[model samples]
Target: MTISQAESHKHLIRTKVWSQLRKVALPDSRFHHDYSSFIADFEGSSAATDLLVSLPAYKNADLLFIAPDNCIQALRYRALKDGKTVLVTTYGIRRGFWILDPNEIHESKWEMASMLDGMERIGRHIALAEITKLPMDIGLMVTGTGAINYKGLRFGKGHGFFDLEWAILYTIGKVNKKTKTIAVVHECQVLDEELRGEVWDTGCDFVVTNKKIIEVEDASKPNCGILWDKLEEGMLEDIEPLRELRSMKK
Candidate 1:
């Protein structure tokens, strides 16, 4: 983690740009109200349905979880109750601070303990390794974001966990072309414009909001190959959870 490496970190720059853009209210957010209405309109939309129940195709998935928001709620509650295993990532607020929830489905609030326990109740409990590494032990991974380009992801503002999670999974030999990852957001989150992306961000295979199950084209996936040679040493350290995980792995 030399100073030179820090100066050249593209992810940091992308994060800064995203933070700036997020305040502008991109065109995608315009659909937030409409998308939310659609979710309420459809009888079988993912979010409005039982959070725990599995659909036909997504049934076999090892993991199926959604981010908690005004748009899509975590379905793990219904999943665990239906006797299925689920995984969830808790929100981070401060230094080395993470709220781990196991059975987050049961608890109404979004925090670490409830989310972790709920996931554990159905099966293994996992979270995005941070904005640095991906989960290797789990078969499925899930997340949500503010907006998604046609390829299925946009820079996550200042939160680096999404990309970091994918990179770490690649390091541990977990994610690949075949890996199934999904993002759930309100329909307003889908973007048609190309979001300037760095070589480190991990794109999603599927984007699900309240209205539809969007299967993005493969060519749109950013950072398809691991840039192991491009591993910015200090950049990883800049993201605290990654540093901790690396230490534990050591």
Candidate 2:
């Protein structure tokens, strides 16, 4: 199938950004830029993390749906320290999710709860069945957009896992238009060119860069829940957690 103009442009931008960052010899040596991930070399991560934590959504949320990203590790730790319940996906939502309760974690192990390996050690794993039952609060979604225009259209590594995550939550009535979704990115990722976005794509309600927080006004977001017809076969098998949710829904 031929790619759309927007997708084509997104690819170009990805290549350009990845190459340029590599030339500069980033602080982190593990550099890899794939179709759906721009991780491991972001420069403005520290400032972005601060900006994200400062948001009211982060401060006030009782239950937070946070993405598993190294850039947002501090946010996770801070949330836990603040006595918030945090829900994070397990590597592509394959193993489902991990729920971290501040009271459950030892004060000394709060750092461990935020790290990937430490998450399994300190947090409780929750399958789709249990996760679907919770009333979600704000979400801190991690995005790897090589380029995003002012319109708030985001381009992922191309796999659309972020969208799928949101769809799953939406299908269970866990989120809605009022849900506060935030993304922390570098100023460079904010581009000038517009990209065509699909309705299923979960656009950010608030964008936090190293410099400031940009509230995306009248942002175009998903109109409905997950469109199961658009899914390929064996999806449930691939994402093990979905298998349970599908069965429960039936």
Candidate 3:
């Protein structure tokens, strides 16, 4: 299928999943828009996080890269409480990346630090060069999904920020073949159909839902770094980290 055709197909799947999630979505006063506009916080988000933390990958990893999605807020809190360092981007990565070191945060503040607004207030913003110099490797990377299939293919909110984040980390050699990737979603978000993923799309090694844990037999991740030619118009000027990263290549 052509790129346009594939995008249309993905849209249909996202619409279907969003519709189902709306019925059981947990009430969050922060959002006023539809589920399609953002990653909706569903009824079983906490349960899914419980199963995620039980995994050997999550237990062994000292550092994690988590997305700033509503559904995975619990995971972020748990990571900090467990004394793990979390690397998170601001919403849409508008402000670039921040590092949340558990040691610096008080135990009473972990819950607040897990939130998006609170993260901005408490987490330390780290520069691209500083990120590359961090001593510890990212052992587990987790992202919230709008929809995912048994094959481990996932679709984000269609903004492509997660894919771009993966590309940046891979380019800097922070994540590699040894890293384990996981997607956390509601059981209703798991679809039965295969998704037509793009070259930049990243897949997961495991899918954790409130219902069960699925280990994808042959899950694949992107090895290529940033495809500068494929970026959206004006993206370099709007995103500070992207702009800095581009100049570094010169």
Best by TM-score: 3
**Tens digit of lDDT per residue, candidate 3, span 152-201?**
89977787888888888888889986689999898888989887678888
Scored against the true structure, residue 75 in model 1 reaches a CA lDDT of 57
lDDT of each: 0.46, 0.70, 0.86
Residue 208 displacement in candidate 3 (angstroms): 0.6
Q: Cα deviation in Å at residue 103, candidate 3? A: 0.8
The digit string of per-residue lDDT tens for model 2 on 166-203 reads: 78777766667777777766676666766667768788
lDDT of 3 at 81: 90
Q: Which runs in model 3 stand beyond 4 Å of their true positions?
A: 27-30
- Among all windows of 10 consecutive residues in model 2, the one with the lowest summed lDDT is 24-33
The alpha-carbon lDDT assigned to residue 50 of candidate 1 equals 37
- Work out the TM-score per prediction: 0.55, 0.86, 0.96
TM-score-based ranking? 3, 2, 1
Model 2: number of backbone collisions: 2
In candidate 2, list every pair of residues with a backbone clash: 35-157, 36-157
Query: Among all windows of ten consecutive residues in candidate 3, which has the lowest summed lDDT?
Result: 27-36
The true-structure Cα RMSD of candidate 1 reads 8.9
**What TM-score does candidate 1 get on C-alpha atoms?**
0.55
